[model samples]
Target: MPFTQAFINESFRFKTLLPLNLMRSSVENSSILGNFIPKNTRVLANIWAVHNDPKVWLNPQIFNPNRFLTDDGKEVIKIDALIPFSTGKEILKTIPLVKQFK
Candidate 1:
């Protein structure tokens, strides 16, 4: 998919997918991997790569929002593999805004 207007418009149904997309970009862009690892280091920066890895997701390159949607398409919840914002991060900066429509 070209990821143009139609894809953007349809994204409303898969709100959580937005963060996943961002994380994928972040991981792909970073080069900290294979460079250095200081002793006693606890945090890592390859979260994005991990989320979209082929071993983790089916057809990761394809933008399938339905992957995150419930089988019945009723509700959406964050899956452990899709951690884009990281745990205990600032809520204000990572929270997704829900839009109410009439």
Candidate 2:
């Protein structure tokens, strides 16, 4: 059943397919969290680190598929931290292919 899909999602989160997202070059000079990013600088988001951050997820290292389920266990909760495909402009590009597998 689809219930097992939650486990799949959790598995992906536990061990991300791509530990680091694709490198993106900054189009313009920018400052993020007080850190300066000059134009053309290559930046990559650590997908594994974000998935394992305690601040964003409780017991992140533990395998807990229940975290993605609703209180009544009827639906999957939309969590902002569960971004294995990345949350940038390329996010939507992966949806169609991902949904086909499900």
Candidate 3:
């Protein structure tokens, strides 16, 4: 069922349920990728952008479940960029349930 799992993963990435993750406010002055951020600034993770980024995914517009499979097609490779749900410790807990129900 590797392809089945891969299909589910690719489906999650192809059309994310929520494009932007829940906003998080900065607690203190900081910077990201050379961009300065002041305290209390609201930040959102664009799950849609990560899933469709050409730099990380080849022909992202095409929904290819095979992209999530290993060369031997025996396992589903987890892509670091595939964060359809908000990322955190809690997200790790939800993945298995999502797959089970799907």
lDDT scores in order: 0.41, 0.71, 0.75
Candidate closer to the true structure by lDDT (higher is better), 1 or 3: 3
Best by TM-score: 3
Alpha carbon RMSD to native, model 1:
12.9
Give lDDT tens digits, candidate 1, residues 31-92: 24234434444433344454455665677667776665557655554444554444333321
Clashing residue pairs, backbone N/CA/C < 3 A, model 2: none
Counting only residues 3 or more apart in sequence or on different chains, how many pairs clash (N, Cα, C under 3 Å) in candidate 1? 0
Which ten-residue region of model 1 has the weakest summed lDDT?
Answer: 93-102
- Off by more than 4 A, model 3: 89-102
Each candidate structure's TM-score, on Cα atoms with residue i matched to residue i, is 0.42, 0.77, 0.80
Which residues of candidate 2, in runs, are more than 4 Å off?
Answer: 90-102
lDDT ranking from best candidate downward: 3, 2, 1
- Candidate 2's residue-wise lDDT over 11-93, tens digit each? 88899888887887878887654567699997777778778878677899899988888877788876666776765855424
Cα deviation at 60, candidate 3, in Å, is 0.6
TM-score computed on alpha carbons, candidate 1: 0.42
In terms of TM-score, how similar is model 3 to the real structure?
0.80
